[model samples]
Target: MSIEIPGYRSGTWVLDPAHSEVTFSVRHMMISKVRGTFGVKEATLIAPENPLEAKVEAKVDVSSIDTKDEGRDAHLRSADFFDVENHPVMTFTSTGTRVQNGDFLVDGDLTIRGITKPVTFEFDFGGFGKDPQGNYKAGASATAVIDREEFGLTWNAALETGGVLVGKEVTIGLDLQGALQV
Candidate 1:
């Protein structure tokens, strides 16, 4: 089967920061999950007539992490996690795209804390349409799970019970809205 978008066109699409969000979730306290959002500094999609041929590049501000807890957020920004002072930005660059079992997948390199690793994100296209301002827009969401330790984020506390305080797996998600450059 071939990938198809209802109104796909070739052009540059700039991410609408106000309508886009970068979120993440990680297992906390070996029982529950903690979620947060990051501020997107910038992102662009170089689209092609064939959606699978498109390329994407994005940058996220590491210091914008908000887990609803100031103290925990501060710790995440420190050397134990993101180390914002040294690595203020995390980035993703698409390398390729493919489809499997009727699902679209985007293969890319995700860099965090100065470490780069290949990751694949399952993508779901939310279709295309024109906004009230008459600008063409596209929407999509993608998600991927990664081992924090693979990115050098090995900080954790031993629990009195058995497991660690923080889970090693982290789920990263992106809800994006982009306007086609006219």
Candidate 2:
């Protein structure tokens, strides 16, 4: 199932931390939204000769979660949420890729707080570019939605207005810029 990633030559690539990010957002107080980013620890993307068979493995530091408030960040790193001391990292590994509606769909397993579940990311290949230093680069974006409770992140408060303090569903977005290493 070979599908072309436009402008990208088939090979392995490494995500450039300076240009890549993974962020997530969740509804807060049933009205507003809170967003945070998890720092990328490392990643390797194997763009196979048959691109559809590509594989990507990544780890994100849960302890690096930041929402601008140190208090909240501490709570997220505590036992109530991510429990970064026990589970310091969240990980993703793609199982396969398929095209639908002219877009690439990556089926993968997302693990958080020791819970592993199958999820899909809407993948977009951003083609190729050359850095000033002459290094070839390829970019892509991926987005997915998941249930926080499913991953054991169920802490919340009930509002007198009738809704919970935090929504159960979370949206995760990944913008990756990979430098071709081979």
Candidate 3:
């Protein structure tokens, strides 16, 4: 079976930052998870008649990384992690879409800190509707796991017990809402 979004229309959709978010989490201290969110600078969706033919491009503000802790946030902006100074924005450009065993997948190139890698995100359609302001809206969510080391984010500390300070694998989640361009 193929994926379908009822009431879907072909057009350009601009991301509503107020209604969208990009979040991530990674193992911390070898025992717990550290979660954070990055501000979405901009994103666009070019929807085609067939959902599988749709295209998406997004830009995230790396300097806007927040984990609720100022110190850690600062460190993340430094050369160790995101290195926001050198690369202020991370981008994703969709390459194609496909279905696997009834699941929707979006294949894209994710660029972080100057490193670009191919990644596949499992996507879920949240349907379309008219918002309270009388604007056409579309919603969707996607998730993917990536290795930080592959993106040049290799900073870590050796734990006294046996593991490392931070986990290498990072899970990224996107809850996106967009307004159809008139």
Off by over 4 Å in 3: 1-3
Query: 42-96 in candidate 1: lDDT tens per residue?
Result: 9999988787888999999999999999999999999999999999999999999
- Listed in order, each prediction's TM-score against the native is 0.97, 0.97, 0.97
RMSD of candidate 1 to the true fold? 1.0
| Candidate 2 residue-wise lDDT, 102-152, digit = tens | 988999999999999999999877779899999999888889999999999
Give candidate 1 regions above 4 Å deviation.
none
What is the lDDT, from 0 to 100, of the residue 128 in candidate 1? 92
Error of 1 at 74 (Å): 0.4
Q: In candidate 3, what are the lDDT values of residues 1-182, reduced to their tens digit? A: 24567788889999999999999999999799999999999999898888788898999999999999999999999998998989999999999999998788999999999999999999888999998889999899999999999999999999889899999999999999999999
Ranked candidates, highest lDDT first: 3, 1, 2
Query: What's the lDDT for residue 66 in model 3?
Result: 94
TM value for model 1: 0.97
